[model samples]
Target chain A: MDIPTFDDVLAAQDRIGPHVHRTPVLTNGQLGDLAGASLFFKCENFQKVGAFKARGACNAVFSLTDEEAKRGVATHSSGNHGQAIAYAAGRRGIHSTIVMPKTAAKPKFDGVRGYGGEVVTCPPGTRSREEAVAAVLERTGANFIHPFDDAHVIAGQGTCGLELLQDAGHLDAIVAPVGGGGLISGTCLAASGFSPATKVYAAEPEQADDACRSKRAGHIVEDDAPQTIADGLKASLKPLTFHFVANHVSEVLTVSEKEIVDAMRLVWERMKIVIEPSSAVAVAAVLKNRELFAGQRVGIILTGGNVDLDRLPWAG
Target chain B: MDIPTFDDVLAAQDRIGPHVHRTPVLTNGQLGDLAGASLFFKCENFQKVGAFKARGACNAVFSLTDEEAKRGVATHSSGNHGQAIAYAAGRRGIHSTIVMPKTAAKPKFDGVRGYGGEVVTCPPGTRSREEAVAAVLERTGANFIHPFDDAHVIAGQGTCGLELLQDAGHLDAIVAPVGGGGLISGTCLAASGFSPATKVYAAEPEQADDACRSKRAGHIVEDDAPQTIADGLKASLKPLTFHFVANHVSEVLTVSEKEIVDAMRLVWERMKIVIEPSSAVAVAAVLKNRELFAGQRVGIILTGGNVDLDRLPWAG
Candidate 1:
């Protein structure tokens, strides 16, 4: 399998530049003081679909050939990626079909539909959702857009890291939350290509530490029904992402669910920006091991801000 | 009594330039679709103390004479102003004393104290808080910094408008939440100075509609114990702010408590930023009177993001 090169990321940036927001880099004196580091937050929460997923999705949809895009795009995601694909497809004036679990939150489905995507719901389970997506793809002949596994997606996510390096200059390290490892893999490539001195770290929830386990075991390790408040980070890394993680990533740090919630609250209070639990995992990793980031310039990727306001984790 | 000239705002900007953030002007497509107009949100919530009050407080602290600052600065505020004063004073390496109502939320007082300000508690009323502030002034020889009525504070707040016009050029109208009217007064001065064609409007919560009533009465009409979810906008407009409002304000629009909450939630969900209820009043005003602002380039001042996270208004 051919891996995406740094040039692909550059191409992705060129493709998605007009579509995605060049999200701002935010800092807080109080948050920095607490973490004992000069922290720069790359706020992808302020992205087009309130997540970094939009970059990859936009790149993929826009890069599609006229004949390929005529049939539309399909993806299976109950979160940001689903909405991202829908949004990107809508921007390209193409149809999008998002396969989601029937048990998924209504708001999640609504988000995809709100972007003008058609939602096809299956029974709750990864297998069921995948099968549903496969059936839809076979029937509609829609191009399958893997949420994090495709080269185009990885290249698109790399644009985020590219922007981070450009805006923040040289950083001691860059941390990103990992689920299927799309963001971290792209970050690794970006750092390797631009700021080779900057180490790339993946932050994962302890309950969903498949990425950590896979890194240690030297292979993809799937988590069996992993449950965490960070609903976005439950998926295990795929072979494409695992290859990048194994080759380039420095380490995968696991944070507890409690720590994720606390870090989310801290960002909301200090930075005064709404971020979902998934984004907080990166910050939690820095806070959990302060010595690693102490006195260093750390760039944390705030992946998304797509939380259900009525069901805040802290309120629970 | 001498009114604050536009040059004072320019001077304040220069003095406070290094201290405060040139907050970003944000726009959301969904929010614009809902309001039936193009909206430019000057996000003061991202300012140094998480509010536009930081500008005024910084100006006030930095502008003080050596002798006046040596004795420290004092103010009576149960919200953002107290915290702003403390933050600004701390930055200047001067002492700050904030007098607050005894019944004020612990978070508000804690915010002031967290910035190293000395806090004095009074009974829960304007008279008691003023007397407490007076007592502090007498004992510490501290220069009392009025939250909104003072010329320096108004000049400081006017910097927000200057920045707004600079960033979101040529707004047809500008809407800001009115409390003690310092922000709106400053906004008026800045708009008049730069973009004179831009009409300035004040948004007031119906629960604390003193500014609207005062405007109609053509005098200062105080609200005795006004109650609203917009805690920062409960104070009545003072003489200095009243003068600016009477002279320059286009109109004062009042929004109900429900509308305020809905608007706040709408911004939180769509914009994905943490903004206080007071800021929502301005957005609500635009939504309530869509005909007045429709098809216009409206600038909405998002005043602050300082809120007790645990005690969110929507949670109630």
Candidate 2:
């Protein structure tokens, strides 16, 4: 398998530049004081579809050949990625299908549909979702766009790190939440190519600590039915992402469920921005181990701001 | 009562330039579609102290003479204004006292105190709060910084409108929530001075529709104890603000409590920004009166993002 280089990321950036938002970098004096570090938050929460997934999905859909795009694009995600692909495909005037679990939240399905994507629901599980997607592919001949594992997706995600480095030059470290590791892997590639001295760290929820365990054990570690409030960070890293994580990532840190919620509330209160729990994991990691980031210029990737309004974690 | 001129606002902008954020103007395609207009949101929600109050507060604090600065400043507020004044005073290396009703939420008091302001709790009511503020002024020789209805404060609030017009030039109309009418009054002054043809509108909650009623009645109609979810917009218009509203404001629109909450949720879900109910009032007005603003370029001032997270209107 060929790894995506910095040049591929630049090409991906050009492809998605018109489609995706160059999301702003935000900072708060209160947040900085609390974390004991100068923090620059790459606010992908404000990105199209309210997540950084839009960048990768835009790159993937736009990268498709005219003949390939004519058939349409398909993905299985009850999350930001599903909405992102739908949005990207809709923007390009192409049909898109999203395969979601029947048990998934109504908003998730509605979000995809709102972006003009057709939704095909299956029973709740990886096997069921995959089978449903495959059936749809066979029936419609739509191209399958993997949520995180594709080279184009990683290259697109790398644009976020590139923007961060450009906006806040010479960061001491960069932190991002790790699920399937698409964002962090892309970040690592960007950092390696652009600013090799800047360290890249992956943050994970303790309940969904597959990435942390995989980094320690020197291999891909799968987590079956992992439970965490950070619904977006539940997936296990794939081989493509694991390869980059093993080769380039400086560390993988894990924080408790409570800490993630606390960090989410802190950001909302201090920065007055709506960040989802997955984004808070990166903040929680920094807050938990303050010494590592103390007195340094750190970049934090706020991955998304998609949340169930009726069911806020703080409400409990 | 002296009305602040556009030149005063320009000066205030310079005074507060180093202290406050020239908040970004944000636009959402989905929100625009919903409102049936091209909308430019002046995101004072991302401003210092999470509100546009910071602009006024900074101007007020920074405008004081050296002797006046040494004497300190005081205000009676249980919302964003208190925090803003405290934050501004702290930044100016001066003391601040915030008088609040004892019945106010603990978070409000904490917010004021967090900004290094002395919190003085009084019995719940206009009279009691005034007495408490007066007592503080007498005791400490502190200048009373009115939350609104002051030339300096209105000049500061006008900076928001100045920035909005500068960023999103030639708006057909600009809408802002009216409480004490500082923001709308300032906006009116700025609009009248810079773009005479641009109409200025005020949005108010039906529960706290003093500004709307006052505009129609041709006088200041005080709502002694208005109750609204838009806590930041409960205050009635004072004479200074009433002058601007009567002479410069084109219209005042009121929306139901449900509309305010719905608009808040719509912004959070679509724009993915944490805006307070007061800010949502302007969006609600645009959404409610779609025909009036349809196909027009509208600038909506998102006044603030200071809210008690645990007591969210949607959670109930």
Candidate 3:
């Protein structure tokens, strides 16, 4: 199916309202001065399971009928999406399994288990995990829940933009970090529906700016080895998500790794919020392309806050 | 001067509304599971100057007339309050002089300067910093802004509770870490005014539970040997604050150093907030006494987030 429409996102908001958090919107005056804009931070870092993934997870799980959910669910993600789907599935009292890279964060690995998902580890950077999850789903008759590519997931992710508009009201633009394009696709639908005057923009890490290049050239582009601190945005955009993003997102911007680190530090030091590098991508883009957002009220979605602090950039 | 009453706190809230943050509140189902209670965290860690100290600082600065502010504002603090008063005074175009212990965190020292304050460094002792500040105030005719002793400071501190109750609504109890008793005194007054059924409790480190002992004995007590991971709660309470706390607060609970560290880690890991040891005191209290708060809605004041990441427990 094509990407969910604005009507679909509104329906997703209704479907996911009971599951996800209505995370707070925050503003820091001192930080605002540095941005040279009135910035409202929609703190998805405080979202359930500590990222915007919960929106997609809830939409995917709830989209299933009781019989379909009873067949169980499964997914492959070493990060936020794994825990999100696990947490969402657990809430429905359904059996769920997550295929994760063996080298995933210990906290995240434990988080999925803590939320009652059966965890299966696979070799990192291999199709082994995906194949293993597909085998498990077939063997157990469990449904394979896509991390971001699924229509339900995009619709679910859109609920974040819906909530942002509900809380912060109108914004000149909404800037979101683009991964598989799930969040931005959802954000676009919501912004288009609620604040039709608002523009939707995507922030991609420079190392993983294939999505930006692809969007400009009107074709899919392979990742440039995908080496970025923003592990969440490393995924190649799916065709369905790319279609929505290409049609709806006003612009896609990129920022360097150094900018991501600096933005992460500023958020930790000034905003007192601990966000992962993936989350910092949005802030990095704002800072890198300051002219585009300066003097315009913008909503910057701080995506996640699950970074390992023991080796956080500021620690050294 | 006496400790400010609820009426006084409400007045201060009105006075300082323009200067201070009605700091956002947050919650997570994951973090609540650890404490075995639903929690509402008033994130004063996001307050101006990175702590609840901003409330009192703004109140103290604005309470002064034009002539009084022209003379300058002076205070002695380990860190947060000093930065707060500095920021507040700077907002009014007044000079600020902060006498801090030489051992205070480097970020805090930078914050004072960053906000345009003169720093007077003294040896690591309350006596040394107090003596240096007193001498400086006498010599320069700067107003001595007592960090948590003066009624205006306490009234200003109470504004945090005012903000908490506004959003957190009715709760079984509100928990805060007590040091000089300024934050707790204000919290108690606000709690009493907003929800008469709700109780106010103070969380203090067992190593420096002078406030707890004082509450039990109905008298102010100074600790000659104070030690705690929560450095912000190591000070002795003054007479005025002691009296208000004795009358308003329901109980003073103490937590072990290990619990403080564990709570700080839990907040950082689960709640996704960069809370300091001092702010962790209340979380420690809740986890330590789960039965008292379990199944009941509880509000916790996350007082600050200024700990050096380099010195984070996981790193060192």
lDDT of model 1 at residue A275? 96
lDDT of 3: 0.86
lDDT of 2 by residue, B1-316 (tens): 7879999999998999999999999988888998899999999989988899999999999999999999999999988899999999999999999998899888888888888999999998888988888899999999889999799999999999999999997899999999999999899989988888889999999999998889899999999788899988888899999998898998999999999999999998888889999999999999999999999999999999988888899886
lDDT score of model 2? 0.93
lDDT of 1 by residue, A1-316 (tens): 6589889999999999999999998877788898899999999999998999999999899989999999999999888999999999999999999998888899888899989999999998878887898899999999999989999999999999999999997899999999998899899889988989999999999999999999999988999989999988998899999998898888999999999999999999888899999999999999998888889999999999988887888884
Candidates 1 and 3 compared by TM-score, better number: 1
Model 3 clashing residue pairs (backbone) = none
Q: Which runs in model 2 stand beyond 4 Å of their true positions?
A: none
Candidate 2 - chain A - TM = 0.99
TM-score of 1: 0.98
Arranged by DockQ with the best first, the candidates are: 1, 2, 3
Write down the lDDT that model 1 would get: 0.92
> Least lDDT summed over 10 consecutive residues: which range in candidate 2 chain B?
B307-316
Residue A233 Cα positional deviation in candidate 3, in Å, after optimal superposition: 1.4
Residue B80, candidate 1: alpha-carbon lDDT: 90
Give a tens-digit lDDT track for model 3, residues A67-94: 8999889999888898999989988989
**What tens-digit string does per-residue lDDT give for candidate 2 at A1-316?**
7678988888998999999899998877788888899999999999999999999999999999999999999999989999999999999999999999899888888899989999999998878888899899999999899989999999999999999999987899999999998999899989998999999999999999999899889988899899999999999999999998888999999999999999999998888889999999999999998899999999999999999888899787
Q: Tell me the tens digit of each residue's lDDT in model 3 across B44-140.
A: 8887778999989899899999989889999988678888988998899999999988887787798899999999999987678778988898888
For candidate 1, the per-residue lDDT at A212 reads 94
TM-score of chain A of each: 0.98, 0.99, 0.97
Clashing pairs in model 1, backbone N/Cα/C closer than 3 A: none
